[model samples]
Target: PKSTPAPDRHRPSSAPPAAPAAARVLWKRGDTGRDVRELQARLRQVEWLVDGPTGTYDDLTERAVSGFQGKRGLPRTGRTDTVTWQRLLGMSHEPGKWDLYLMGGQPAAAPDLRCTSGRVLCVSKSSRTLRWMIDGRTVSTMSVRFGSQYTPTREGVFQVYWKSRHHVSTLYDSAMPYAMFFSGGQAVHYSYDFAARGYAGASHGCVNVRDEAAIADLYAQVKTGD
Candidate 1:
């Protein structure tokens, strides 16, 4: 009898089976429910759902979804699929019932203690709002965005050190119109991406104001060393 063949040491062991993909409920036009409402709310947070969450997946919702997918290099199906939902969720906060349904009135967030003073740009990450305050009175307030975890917006008291109209970031190659620099490279500026994508995206290390009119007004009022 022939001797048994030696074990092949160079042979690779069998790999483990791939994990199954999570089963996700696909949402398309005409879909209506809490889930759809949540999706709409998340989209609104990112500024995609400009009209707010309607619970029903209508034409507007479909368009918003398609736009978002296109921007993110998704399938552009204009429908909520697993990949789309996951990407949206990662960039957005959990949708509260009020955020989803708009059943309750939205109240203005109280200014931070540090913001109660002379002319100041009161940026509140908690409420995602920025209040232009003068003598402790709010001149104007608008929705704002902050940088991501890797490039967080600096907190605490800071004065406007510089002002630039129609500025662009040399580091990131992004437009930063109406920029009021407070802390180093970080500034309070108008972000077109924020207006377009909403909370779905973040800045490098700046306070992003979405309302162009509000930022323009603020920029006009703000002075260097203010």
Candidate 2:
């Protein structure tokens, strides 16, 4: 009888992180392929990478993935395994509520949304709350989870860059990233399932609201700096 050949040390170019064979190969040092390209595109959406086309896992991609891994409190192996690959693809297994903790309570004072013309409204993931101002009056309120720790909304001052009533996603099942980018890959949009815990926190760092009215209101009133 002939013995079976050894599994390919190299990973295929199109395997998802959840594939059973993902554990058999090292993806970082491996050559680039369609799989790597997919990863590049997804990473770009979340602002984890700035360069590298969809194809190979080049040095730049490796570095970017490494940095991401480090930031996520994972091993800095740089090699793409099932766990790392899942995160890169935004398909990470849900971490239960116990895994997450809030060190500080919600902001003691509400956020100031008044005259936010030239300022950005930042939401604290740690606090699961949002702060904005209008007419010099502060409005600090709790917000639903739009993404998970793995695919969190970015932090920065972004303009109301774009708007859309009907959006689509190639990776996810629904449309999001609707309007306004506030920095660090975060956005404000519409979705009603924000209360579902881990399952609801699946956006690619985009803030999801409760309905069309909310998004519409934001889209019309918000300006480049507001």
Candidate 3:
């Protein structure tokens, strides 16, 4: 007996079964959990998910995510994938309950100290707010927009050198109501586009006020010098 054909080296042995691969959970509409809640909270900080952190991904969240993805040149999948989550995380701050729910009133931001003297149209880029101040006292506040990266609004001290109640831009051929000229072509003016689109649009090197009534009142109060 050929000694027991040398123990077969190629024969398969019965081994314990391998574990199945874990399934990945892609956060999408209708998915509910802490992850979805966190996604909503982050979206809100960037002004995308205006109504939630509802803890469940819904139609509104999908639309908001799609819009955000479109703006950032990402594929408009509306679903939160790894790439989307990373992008959103990079752009937003850790969300607070107030931010997630938009509870309470608009949070107040400290006025820039440089704007604490005399009559000033104190615009803060960080806060995206305009504070109408007189002698260090804030008389009024309103939402405002600034130029895009290509035509950034000039910062630092500026003065109102001209005023035009119904000014139309000769360059861009756009109407700039209640225009108060400051740095070069930049002015504080009412932007109909801002009113309609909210923060979805940008101004052309100008401080754009969405509230027409507020800007009109401000235009009247502000003199050519201040």
Candidate 4:
């Protein structure tokens, strides 16, 4: 009786436990929060996903996340866990290669432009080039793609009529309209895919450039007739 089974030596202790586990990131599928928003942004940056203004997890985002995960040899859970988030943000062991901001880096400004009021708007649809005149001298000349015969870019004097940080086009949304739309509905816009000079040419009826800021700077240097 005094031994009393040694006070149950094999009994387990319950001392209020250890720290709680971290929360898992839920991507576009039953998730609606800031983390999902970040995931969408990162995915879009890498061209793995399309435009979505909402953070609620949807089927499109789920598919994109799965595709991205498969491409990276991840688990393909379609959920943005810590590992997925890290990979998406370029912080994982195998980071995403594409840099979205690289679109802002243009090769160079047009070198030869004629100085004149309307010369800045001279974009040749046939040659796929643009020419600008300043002070009666050619100041800028560069390769460009004008609209096709079906939707030709209007040939005339256009100004920096409208600037939009998030302009939506008929085919796509979230366009950056740099120089104005002098033609019917066409405008000089920033095209991320235009980084490769003359390699590709596709536009409804507008001029597409690499860097928006560069075009903006060029536009700023000009006047109505300077």
Q: Once model 4 is optimally superposed onto the true structure by TM-score, how far is the C-alpha of residue 101 displaced, in angstroms?
A: 24
Tens-place lDDT digits, model 4, residues 51-154: 53245678888888889889988878887777677777683232121122222212334433432444455555444555556444556655455566787767
- Sort the candidates on lDDT, descending order: 1, 3, 4, 2
Candidate 1 C-alpha error for residue 203, in Å: 0.3
Name the best candidate (by TM-score): 1
Q: How much is 152 displaced in model 2, in angstroms?
A: 1.9
Clash count of each predicted structure: 5, 15, 0, 19
Q: Each prediction's Cα lDDT score?
A: 0.83, 0.56, 0.82, 0.58
lDDT (tens digit, per residue) of candidate 2 on 70-188: 98887777666677777665643332332221111223344434335344454555445555545544443434455667886766545666555566655566666345655533567
Worst 10 residues of 1 by lDDT: 98-107
Q: How well does candidate 1 match the true structure in TM-score terms?
A: 0.60
- Which one wins by lDDT: 1 or 2? 1
Q: How do the residues 1-226 of candidate 1 rate in per-residue lDDT, one tens digit apiece?
A: 8999998999876898789785364999999887888888899889897775667899999999999999999778898888899899899999774576342113458998877888878887777778888889999888787889999999888889889998988998988999999999999999888776666678898998877888898899988877
Off by over 4 Å in 4: 1-119, 156-160, 196-199, 211-213, 222-226
Local accuracy of candidate 3 as per-residue lDDT tens digits, 46-138:
888666455779999999988998998978888877777888999988876434432212345898898898999998877778999999999
RMSD of each: 14.1, 19.2, 9.2, 12.4
Give the worst 10-residue stretch by lDDT in candidate 2.
97-106
